[model samples]
Target: MGVLPLVHALVPNSVGNLGSLLETVLPWAGLAVPFALLAALRRRSASAAVAAGVAAVLWLGAFWPVVAAGAAADEPNLTVVTHNVGAENADPAGTARTLLAAGPDLVALEEITDDALPAYRKALDKALPHSVRIGTVALWSRHPLTDTRRVVLDPGWSRSLRAEVRTPGGTVAVYVVHLPSVRVGLFGFGTAARDRNIQELDRVLAQERQDKVLLLGDLNGSAADRSLAPLVRRLKPVQDAVGGGFGLSWPAAFPLTRLDHVLGRGVVAVESWTLGGTGSDHLPVAARVRV
Candidate 1:
């Protein structure tokens, strides 16, 4: 029983890659696996087996990372904000105003439509002088952007993109992604498409040579999900840096689970938090990092 906490904490951070449905179930399953192994090894009593199973399940699903805070940093800072403004978002002006007020050095937006683009452009034009938009995902920055290119996450879907921003501190490769959403059914979690998207993203992240990388998106799954392992393995989640909790982001009104995130690699997080309502289904997430 004492070793359970240690086992739970040491498990590689693969759980976040599992997507949404599997996100909830796999950890619980992971917890039970150890107990089942113990039962087989010791031929333990039924009650002992049940108790071990429960402990493992709890440790995997609710503890560990939940208690781990983001890494500390000491250097120049860059503030970034990410939000998935719903496709049919009505208050583009208000959302833009709110985000601009945050004074982020970089901003990534997803689910942008032609109709709302103009309003957003007008609203952010003064603060964010440089910008790039591909399909529905876009990046706006206070600094110049170089080596900008549309990252082909899926030949079938033309929405994600990657760009290198030239900040005073250094060049940071930023990827703005809107992964496919997953669905739940009687049998179990269904995430074939989301998994494929993650694989494509994995290839992109693997090939990156830049020292600093920032991934901002509506991942549709929390760090606890396993399907996002490809990205999670390489990048550190911002929420885990500056402690406050999960920073739940979906269903802005009463967020219970974190769906949007700001992940970084070769960069240190200074602070991270959820932005207030954006008139969309998701609440925006922002992070300050030292590059």
Candidate 2:
């Protein structure tokens, strides 16, 4: 139990997001750790009780974001949806329709390939008249998009893009990003490239001059994940600020980690939540924010 809190903090999250994964599942320990603490107390194990108490403190501290309350989503300035329409999704059209039916002011997508691009464009063209596709990342908006360009966070590929949305309230800079994926194995977490990609994106965000910015997509990391501190510090995760709970949205069937997120800078998240899967590995994350 004593080692539990230490483990949580010292986790080398950079290795393969091992630390992040640990944090993602840390809440479960809240239940198990106390039970163990009670058993230890009953057994009159002073050391065990102390250790359990430490673990409980650390666990709750790490979990505060999930339970914290914030502004409501009512009367939102903007309603956005971000999804990772899996590259192999069987029904891209269906996913597109489902996303559109949500009536989002903007839709940000990751994992869009050349072949799948046309399908999405065709499906969204009528409803979202303004759209931009730069490599694998795309943004379709009900508002006009201008000054769009690829962000180039990774080498040899495009996984991020930027555009300015002319909304009813004002123009907000929108970043559609698909950060490099991390992996795990005997080799531990493989976040080298992913880390590098994050560094580059971090630099770009640091220089961002926009007053209101919306970051949307499959970041491949959670808001609480240590590896994402740089971005998290600059932006407010909609889910963490207003979500009722974990709001997990990955591995759709048994959604666990929140790999997809909608974060904001200079905006207030009124509401946030994850929707049921739309033939993708990740469930769509939606948020309403006050600009």
Candidate 3:
């Protein structure tokens, strides 16, 4: 487990997409070191203690930055928020108010149903005047949105969109996406659909001409997963810049892994954090950045 992060890419996924599974819960592996160390102390085994210490070192070496992020502080220039206000969310209007309370300059939402769209629009229209939406994904900006269009990653439907936000700082391109979901069934990691979408999204991102870009929404995969390496390599995760928090944003009741993320290129993330549940299964993710 200690070495999983370094060799995650090399781990074969032909069987069950084990590599992706391990990466999804990679941070949790550090918990094992404490148990190992306790066992070593109880047994008074020098070799066991040495092994535990080594594991501790390796785990800390890889994740210390995430631990340190808790202390990060900054006066941000722009704030962006992203949330998957579940299709079945009981309180879409309340959720919209929760997001508005964060005072984000830009907001991206996913899994928005036709029924809930009106509630969201009514709640956010006045504050965030400019908006663009296609299919279930939407982008709302406090500034003007221009050159807006639907980004068709999958044919016959729209689940992604791109818009240019003319903010006081400058014009920045923002892409809001809701990638295919990943499920773990009897067949193993059911990520074929999600993986395909990731590749398609990567292709679209590659051709982007914007000097500054922000990608937000439910990616359905962890940033640590090798399958998401292409996008992770191209854009920096805002959580990483904060220096010390996992920013896990899913299963709001008891979030285990981060499915929602705020990623950007040609921008600096000064602060990043996750918000409380908004009557949805997933929590909202927020980032304050300098564009």
Alpha-carbon TM-score of each model against the true structure: 0.80, 0.88, 0.95
Using lDDT as the measure, name the better of candidate 1 and candidate 3: 3
TM-score winner between 1 and 3, please give it: 3
Error of 1 at 152 (Å): 1.0
lDDT of each: 0.80, 0.83, 0.88
Superior candidate under lDDT, 1 versus 2:
2
Would you list the clashing residue pairs of candidate 3?
Answer: 66-244, 68-243, 69-243, 69-244, 70-244
lDDT of 3 by residue, 62-147 (tens): 88887685543546678999999999999999999899889999999999899999999999999999898799999998999999
Ranking of candidates on TM-score, top first: 3, 2, 1
Q: How many backbone clashes does candidate 1 have?
A: 16
Model 1 TM-score, 2 decimals: 0.80
Whole-model lDDT for model 1 versus the true structure?
A: 0.80
| Residue pairs whose backbone atoms clash in candidate 2 | 16-189, 72-270, 73-270
